[model samples]
Structures are given as structure tokens and as C-alpha cells.
Target: LPASQQEHIFNAAWGGSHKTGQLICNACNQSFSTNVDEVFSLYTTAIMNAWSFKGQRHKSVPIIELDGDYVLEAGAKLRIKPEKPLFEEKNLPNGQIRTKISFNSKGEAKRWLNNGGAESWLGRSLTPEEREYLLSLIKESEPQRREPEPQEASTTLNLRNQYRSSAHTILKCLGFFLPDLVCSPLTQPIRQFARYDEGDWRLFAVEPEQFFSLGEEITNLLGLGVYHNSVEIYWSSSSRMIVGILTLLNRVKRAVIISNNYAGSDKILYVFEDTNLSKKPPTAILAEIDSSKFCQPLLGVQYFAQPTKMYEYFYNELVGLTSIYNPIDAMKAELIKSLEEVNKHHTTLEGSTIDQYQTLYLNFFIKLGKVLQVSVDSVKIDSKLQEYGFSRLRLELKGRNITDPEVESIIVQAFDSVLSDWTQNRL
Candidate 1:
């Protein structure tokens, strides 16, 4: 038995007088039979004793960096215990509350920041840019309304004056005007100008008109509310039109719906969601005839030609992949060849790192099939390993190949159908 260094034999006597003796192990302070057979069993039992494992304190240790090529199983569960918060709120001299937190671990902090936690949420100190932008908004504006004369307010403030003061107080208390404090603006529907020739039709708003004329009889007839998309169809009068015109243009290439309130025009604008020109235009077209010469384009119409968000997302993905693997042209070529082959086979393929190649192949395959007009049931992209893999170094597709003659021919036909579009797009 393994014993403490302090262990020593208490006593030992080998003779007939001490035929069956007791042996003392000073380490454990326990006595055992000194008879040959029993002593061997006692020593064996002590040596073979099982001790429960005492693990190190997990809270104090930092997480080790994960391997770049580490592959995790599909059912893997990752647990991350957050570190102590490093920052607290600190009031600034300018009455703005700043964060006490500074970037102690830049890499980890950056990752945390990128995962939708703004610096303010992290209680991090503001950058100079943020500080300047905030300061500009926070600076008080000169009062637009005239102050009450001393003679007029002999006692308490009037109701109007009280309301203004209350509003100002509320704005300050709620931090409505503070940078990054307000809710995000509402999402506007996609807007596009239907260009037929030199003249293009677009949605426009009329000059802001009061819904309730303050002192006029119309005030009794109409309640106060903001008006939107109020356009003049004829020289006679202006009326409110439903934004349904956008939906009509999306569904049908051509459709005419009468506007009951407005007499002169019944045409709706045409706006298709296509990214290319050769794609067949939707069967319906919506166009409006404006007999009134007074209709003018709204402000900021010239800057509406930017690509849709989907395209931007695609660009971002490509840029990210390029950054990870430099000389992207080679990767692009390899990807194109592999994607074309996958399209040609019309079968599922497994990838080493499922996230990257799977996404890339599925997107390309689906899009290619769409352009070719062959609607497949689903794009197949399986993982090479049953579990999830993180490494992205592998390029070759390394799984089962579809050998069905009929399916292969069908894929070839689809590829041939979109060959022109593919070639043009590749260039």
C-alpha cells in the first residue's frame, strides 16, 4: 500500500512466540494481521482502494482557444460561463452617463461586440466618433416659440406653457433624443421607379397639409392625423390612395384599378423584383396616367438604384470567404467547377466542413436550377462526418456520387438550358 512518507514499522518480531502478530501502519494509524496470507490481502486491498477524483476549480480558469480545424459532433453541447462584468456606469461632467468599462481583452470584447451587443450595452467607453455624434444631438436647441411677456403671466404659467415644459422634461428623462437610445425606424417597403422611357413613375407625397384647419369649420369635420402618399391625379383635386399599388405591380405586370376619389387617372406603377432584364416580365403591368402637370418627384429619388439587401448579403459572404482563403480567384474557380458538376449530377453531395461548402453549393445550385427552369425537390448538401465540423480547409467534395443515368441526363439537360446565362454571368 502507498503510504505517507512518515510511515514506519511500529514493531516486528519473527519467532514462534509471536506466531500471529499485529502489524501497524503509522501512516493510516491502522493495524493489520501480520500472518503471511492475511497481510498480503490487507496490503492488496489498501493499494487497490478507489479514490474519488477532485477536479480543479473551473471558475478561475480561462477558456482555452479552440483549434482552427476542430470538428464538433452534430449533437455537441457547448457551455460558456460568462466572465465577471468589467464595467459600471460612470456619470460624466457634461451630465452624460458614460461606461466605466474599457477594453481589457480586445479579441474577446470584439467578438462579443460583433454578436449584436453594442458597445453601450457592454458598458464600454464611447469612441470619439460616438461621443461627438451624441454631443451634437444633446446640445439644446433655441426655443422656436416666443416667451410670454412679464405682464401676461402675473401668477402661474398658462396650460400651453405647462405642456411645452412637460414635453421637454419627458424628452430629457426618456433620453429619446440620445444617441442609440431610440427604437429603430420602421422598415419601409421596397421602392423602385418604373422606367419605361425618359419619364418614370414613382410614389410621391404631397405638401404636408393640416388635417384639421385650426380655426376653420373643417376642424369640426376632420380629426387631426398625418397624411401619407397623397397625390394629385387631376387638376381638379388631390386624394389619398392605398399603398396597394405596390402589391399590384408586384403580382401583375399590367392592371388598371379606378380611384373613386380621383377622376383623371387609374394607372398603377410597374415594379418587378427581378435582378436581371432577360427574365420574363410578370404577366401584369400597373401604370398610372397623371393628367395633372403639377405632380413632381419626391426628394431622394435619385439615390434609389442601389442593389437589394440580398445581393449585399451575398457580396459579404464572398468577401468573408476570400478573407479566410486568399487568392479567391482559385477558390472561385474551384467552387464554380464543383457547383456546375453538382448541378449536372442533380444529386446530394457531402462536404468536409458542412457550413461553408454546403451553404455555397446550395445557394448556387438552387439559383442555377431556378435560372434553368428545372424545379428540383430539394438541394442536397450532407456533412462528410455525421457530426458538425468547423475546419474550412478542405475543398473537394468527398462523398457518394449519384450514378443514375436518367437523373444525370435530366441534370445535363437543365445545365444545357441555362448554359448561356451561366456563361454570361461567369464573365
Candidate 2:
């Protein structure tokens, strides 16, 4: 097939076509969702996960770059950066963007960059300390993000700091103090472990709060371990591998490792970490493998480049990383597992203007409920809420004298809590 056709097929395989219909994959036979949007969303995320892809816009703006190829990556707080560089940039009215990105070396960074990513810095450009500072400032200000606005930058910082719960941590930042023998493997495939100066040896480890305060960009490094609301880490003595544990905020109840691979296709990437009398118990289980039949996944995964390292690191650093958070009664807990994704995207309220706006919506729901005013249990204010109708109510409130400050204040509070309720009830 032609390269263009191959790329199109590759993109399609990752994300299905927009034309929805019943289709069966011989591989799974189970019907995959025929929805184009769902397919594309997951495709985008999976591609984004590869840490490839070139520069794309978030709301249509390109991000800041540190060099021709290297860019200051952004996280979800900034929408993580990819490993791309040296793409063209175009100055949009509101932001800058990379105009062209092809399959260049670092596995098509422009793709990732375009998908809410920036450039990645490997090797030594600055000390971890220096980078950490700039990352913190960027999180707070995000002054250099794709199409970042003054208000958005300031708001991003405030939200990060405010909700900066050490809960639901996907990965942890490491300090140089890892036991000399506990140092990260020298040749991990994952880019997070690229050797710095002389192998990432550090005499000092910065505090998490202090580190983020520095306001620079940070690269995400993966390790096997238990991550919960309180993130922590430990490593094996051989230095061949390490594990970490963390606590995600309440919002991100848990991270579901949808699929992972380790050991050529011979081993299924399950056990989050291997344990021995010397190694101690691990924190979570990343995959369960059929060590015997491990080749096929490799077929599709080959395009990922450096599969050995990625898989090796997967086995060594990310297996059994999740079992730590599994509930004692596994069967019963399954009920809540489905909500994990919802938690990931929603925010819990802390009194803020956004929260205030939520309160207004709640009041609308409440007033609407009263209009329907039936039984205490029967009136579902949110269920009947309509976007256009509600806005009309708000304008009518203000258009006349009925929407007084007291009513407005009530609306604001309801608005603040609205999202929380929506997530809670999906109302």
C-alpha cells in the first residue's frame, strides 16, 4: 500500500470511521462502538499516549517552544507535551502553532504537539531544579501554552494550586536521593529516564510543593508501584527497576491500564511488579501475560519504535502498580469502577467564581423544581433543566427587577455546585 494509504489505515484502525454501523473485529468479535466520535477520541488519546504526534492546537492555538525541535511540554493542567520538535510555526490571531509536521525522527512529535502537546526536552538543557521551577510557573501562568490567555493562564495556576491534592497521581517526580543502587535503569525505553548529566543521580530531592512552585515544565516518568491519593515510591536494589505509589485526587478515582505489553509477545503485561523474597510485595498489578503467546500484540505495537525498551520498562516498572488500590471485596467494587473516567474529567468544588456560577444553575433548577412542585421526592430540578430555557430565565431575571442580587447570589452558589451535582447525578 502507498504511504498515504498506510497512514490512513493506521489512523482508521486506531479510530473507527465516522459512519456508524455494526462491524465485528475477528480479533475481538465483540462489537466495538461504531460511533465515530468515540473511536476518534480514544484514537486520539492512544496516539497522544505514545508521546509522538506533532504540534496541534488545543482551542486552535499552537504552544510555546523552547527550541527548534524541543518544546516546553504541557500537561492536562497543561495537556502533556509530546517528543517532537523542529516543526513549522504559524502565528494565528490569538496563538502560535506548528504549521507542518511529518514523520520526523522522534516518532512524529508534531502529531503529539498538535494534540495539545508541546516539545519535550531530553538530555541536559537545564537542571531538574531549574526545569521544575519553570514548570511550576507555567502551570500557574501557562504563559507560553498554545493560545494561552492572561485569564486562562492565571486561572490554570490557581486551579492547579488549589486542587493540587496529592491524590490520584498518575506518576511521581523523583528526587536525586534514590538509593545509589536504587537508581533508575540506565537503559529504560521510556523517554522519562533519558540519562541526565551522568545518569540521573541526585544528592537532593525537592519537596513536591516546592518543586511545583518553581513553575517550569516536567516530563512524566513511569515506574511500577502503588499510586493512590498519597503518592509514594520505592525501588529494587538491583536498580534494574523501580516502583511508585500515588493517590489521585478524588476526581480521578483510578487510572485504568486498558492494555499493556511486556516481554516480546511471550508475556502478557499484567503483574504490576514482580516480587521475590528480596524484592518485597509490589503495589499494583499492571498486566497478566500468557508468556507463551506474546507475539501478536507486538505486530500492531511495532510502529511504536523501541518496543523492547517500552515493553521491558512496562514489565519492570509498571506491573502490579494498581492492585494496591483494588478494594478488599473486588466483586463489589466493580460497580464503581465504571465511574473512574467520569472522575478523571470532573472537578470537585472549592469555593470559587466558577463554583458560584454553578450555584446559579442550581437555583434555576430549584425554582424550576418548585414550579413543578410536586412531591419532595418527585421533583427533579436538574432532570428538566434546559440550556436555552434556563438562559432565558436568567435574562428575564435581569431584564426585569426579579433577578435581584440575592437571587443572583443564590444563582452563583447553585452554579458553583452545579457541576459537582452533574457529575454526582450526571443531571
**Against the true structure, whose TM-score is highest?**
2
Residues 195-215 of candidate 2 have per-residue lDDT tens digits of 111222111111121112001
lDDT to native, each model: 0.27, 0.27
Q: Could you give candidate 1's per-residue lDDT for residues 1-427 as a string of tens digits?
A: 2334221111111000111112122322232222111212111111111111111111211222223322111111122323543668878899998754333344545554555455547378667786555445334323233332212111121222212222211121122122121121210111111111111221121122222211123212232111000111111224422122211101111111111133333333222222112222222233344434435411111111334743463345334322222222223334556656555644543343234445654455455454346653332222221112212222333343544444334333333333333445531
Model 1 misplacement above 4 A: 1-239, 242-282, 285-341, 345-356, 359-427
lDDT of candidate model 2 versus the reference? 0.27
**Candidate RMSDs in order:** 39.3, 25.1
Clash pairs detected, candidate 1? 252-284, 253-284, 253-285, 254-284, 254-285, 267-287, 267-288, 268-286, 268-287
